[model samples]
Target: MLTTNRLRQQLAQKQTVFGLIASVPAPIMIEVIAYAGFDFVIIDMEHVMINPETVEHMIRVAEQSGITPLVRIAEINAKEILRVLDSGAMGIVIPQVEHKEQVEAVIQAAKYFPIGQRSMNSGRPGIFGRDDLADYMERANHEIMIIPMIETVQGVEQIDEILSVEGIDMILEGAADLSQSYGVPWQTEHTLVRQALDHIQQVATSRQIPYCAIPRQINQYEHWQNKGVHAFVLGDERGIAFRALQSKLAQFPVINTDRSQTEL
Candidate 1:
C-alpha cells in the first residue's frame, strides 16, 4: 500500500500525481482501477452509495493491487472518520469545512490521543489484532492524512486560517460548489472563481501545504502543475464508464444485444 508520506514525497518532487474517484461500490472495480495505474483512488462516501462493509473489502483489494486507497468521508464527523481510518485507508478527504473549529474537530477525531482523541481499536491498520493497540494509536495519527475540502465562499475566505491549522495536510478545492456559491454555477473561468483558486494556491504555496484541484478544463492541469500544484484528482468512474461505452459502441454497426457483452 502507498503510504501518505510516500505520496507527499512524490508531490514534493513535483511529480504529476494522478488519481480516480471510485464512485462504483464493487470491490472488483477497485482492483480494476488499481491495475489501470492510478496513483490513488478515493472511495467516495460523500456522494456515492457505498456501505461500510463493502468499502472495507474494496480498500483491502486496492491495497493488494498496489494502489493507495483514500476515503472521502460523508462529512466532518469524527466517529465516522475513526471507522474508516481504522479500516486501513491510506488517507481521508473531508468535505464542506467552512471554519477553523470544524477543522479542529476533524483533526481531533481522526488522530489519536496526544494529538487527537481517536479511540483505540484492533482493526486492519493494527494488522487485525496482532499489533499492540496503544502503539498503533500513537503512530497512526502521524501517518493518516486529513484533507479538508475548501469549496464554499466562506471556506475560500478563511483559506489561510484553515491552512495554518495543525493536523491538516491537504486541501481539495470544490470548484463547482464554490461557483454555485458565487452565483455563477459551473463557470470555471469566471474571474471570481479564478481569483478564489489563485488565492487558495498562493496561500497554500506560501504555507507549504498540499492543495488539490479537480481540473474540469484540459489545460488547467498543466496550468496548476506549472504553478507548483502537485495533487491532481483526474476523473470520475461514471466518465470512465461513458468513455468505454462510447468506444465500444463506435465499433458495432448495430445494437447487438447477444454479442454486446462478448465484444466489450
Candidate 2:
C-alpha cells in the first residue's frame, strides 16, 4: 500500500527533520541509519556505483527500516528518474539545475499524466502492481517529490524562476559544489558562498517550499537551525563512518613496535 511521504510530512509541518546521504552502497547501512533515528535517507546514485538490483534492495530495506528514502539521481533525464522512482524511491535530488527549464523538465519526467508526461509502469512503489493503476498514478503524482539542487552561481541567480515552477517540493543547497563553483574550493562557509546560500534560503522561505542543506562542520548546524531551516542531510555514510572510526581511534593508546637485539 502507498504511504505518506514522511519527509514531506515533516516539511509541511515546519518541523526540523534530519537525514543522511546513504553512500555506503549497503542495504544494512541504510537500515542502520534508520535505526540511528534519521528521518530520511538519500540513496546516493550520483557518486556511488551500486548496481540497479542493489539499489532496489536498499530501498526495500529503507521501507522495512521505516525511513523515507530519496535518491540523488545521476542526471536529470526521464529514464533515470523513472527507474529510480519505479524502484521505490519516495523522492529525487537532481543536481546542477541552473534554469527554470531544467526544473520543468525534471517535473515533467517525475510526475504522471495531468501533471507530467512520465511513462507509466508498475513497480514496488505501486505495491508491485496490486493497487489499481489509476489510483496509484493519482497517489504517486501527489506523493513523489522532485528536489532540485542549487550548486552554481547561475542556479542561485535563477532560484526564483526554478522555485516558481510547480511540483518542486524542495530545494537543496549543494554546499561543497557551490563553494567550488564560487572559487572558494571547500570553504563552504566563505562569505561569498554564504551570501548565495542565504539568497537561496530567502527565496525558498518566501515561496514556502522547504530548503535543505548539509553541514560539513558539526558546529555549523546551529546557523541553519537559527534560520528556520527545516530539512537537513547529515553528511554521507562513508564520512560518517570514517569520522566515527577516527573518533574511536583517537581514544585508544598508540601502539609502538621496535625490533632490536638490545631491546628484545
Candidate 3:
C-alpha cells in the first residue's frame, strides 16, 4: 500500500542513507536485507529475471520490515514503470538515461495528472480503493520518486537538461556502465570514468539535486561523504554474500590428502 516515503524524507533532511541492490529475487532475502539495517533496496528487474508477482512480494516484505523498496527497470517503458509503481514501489530507478525527453517520458508514466499522464487505478498504491482517490493521487505525486541514472557519456553531457526536468527527485551515478561506455569495460575506477563521475556529481550538487553514489573502492565511501552525498547503494547483495562465504571458508585450513603419506 502507498505510504510516506521515508527515504525521500531522509534525503530531504540531509541524512546519509545506505542501500543494496537485490539481484536475488526472493522476498525472504528482501526481509533479511531490511532486517540487516539497509535504508532501501533496489529490487533489480534490469539484470535479473524476477517476475511482477515476486517484485510485489519483495515490496510487501520491505514494507513490513521497515525498509524502502525501489524498483530498477531496464529502460523507459511505461508499462513496466506503471506495473512496478502500482505494485507499491516507492520509487523507480531508470538506467542509461541519456536525454531530457527520456526523463520527461518517465515522469509521464510515473506521475499522476497535472504532473504527468500516468494512467490511474485504485491498486495497492491507492490502498486498494480504501483511500480517497484524489488524496491518493496527490500523495503519490508528492511522495513517489522519479530517479534517473546517468551512465553513458551522452547522459553525462546532458546532465543539466535531465536534471532540469521538474519531476526528477534524485540522480544516481552508474560507474560500471559508465566505465564500459568510456571504453574501459569493468574499470569502474579508471581515470576517465572517475572524471565523468566527478563531473556528474559536481553538476548534480551545483543544481541542488541529491546524487547517489555506489562506492566500488574502499576509500570511496569517505570520498563521497566528504563531498556531502547523502545516498549510497552499496554493491549488490549477491556479491556481498559471496565474499562473506569465501571469508568464512578461508578461516579453516585445508586438509592434506596425499595418498602416499597415508600408505603406512
Choose the strongest candidate by lDDT.
Answer: 3
lDDT of 1 by residue, 123-146 (tens): 778876676777777667777887
Deviation in Å, model 2, residue 70 alpha carbon = 0.2
Ranking by TM-score: 3, 2, 1
Which lDDT tens digits does candidate 2 get at residues 1-264? Answer: 357888888899998889899888889999899999999998998998888889888988988889998999888879988888888889988889899998888889888999999899877778778879899999989889889999998998889998999888999999899899999899988999989998999999999889897877666688888899978888888988998999999999788766565583
Which 10 successive residues of model 1 have the least lDDT summed? 1-10
Error of 1 at 109 (Å): 0.7
Residue 3 shift from truth in candidate 3, angstroms = 0.7
Summarize candidate 3's per-residue lDDT along 1-264 as a digit string, tens digits.
898999999999999999999999999999989999999999999999888999999999999999999999977899999999999999999889999999899889999999998899999889889979999999999999988998899998898888888877889999998998999999988999989989889988888889999998769988899999989999999999999999999999799898998798
After superposing candidate 3, which stretches have Cα over 4 Å from the reference?
Answer: none
* Residue 219 miss distance in model 1 (angstroms): 0.9
Task: Give the RMSD in angstroms, all C-alphas superposed, for model 2.
Answer: 1.6
lDDT of each: 0.82, 0.88, 0.92
Model 1 lDDT at residue 253? 77
The clash count for each model shown is 0, 0, 0
Off by over 4 Å in 2: 255-264
- Candidates in descending lDDT order: 3, 2, 1
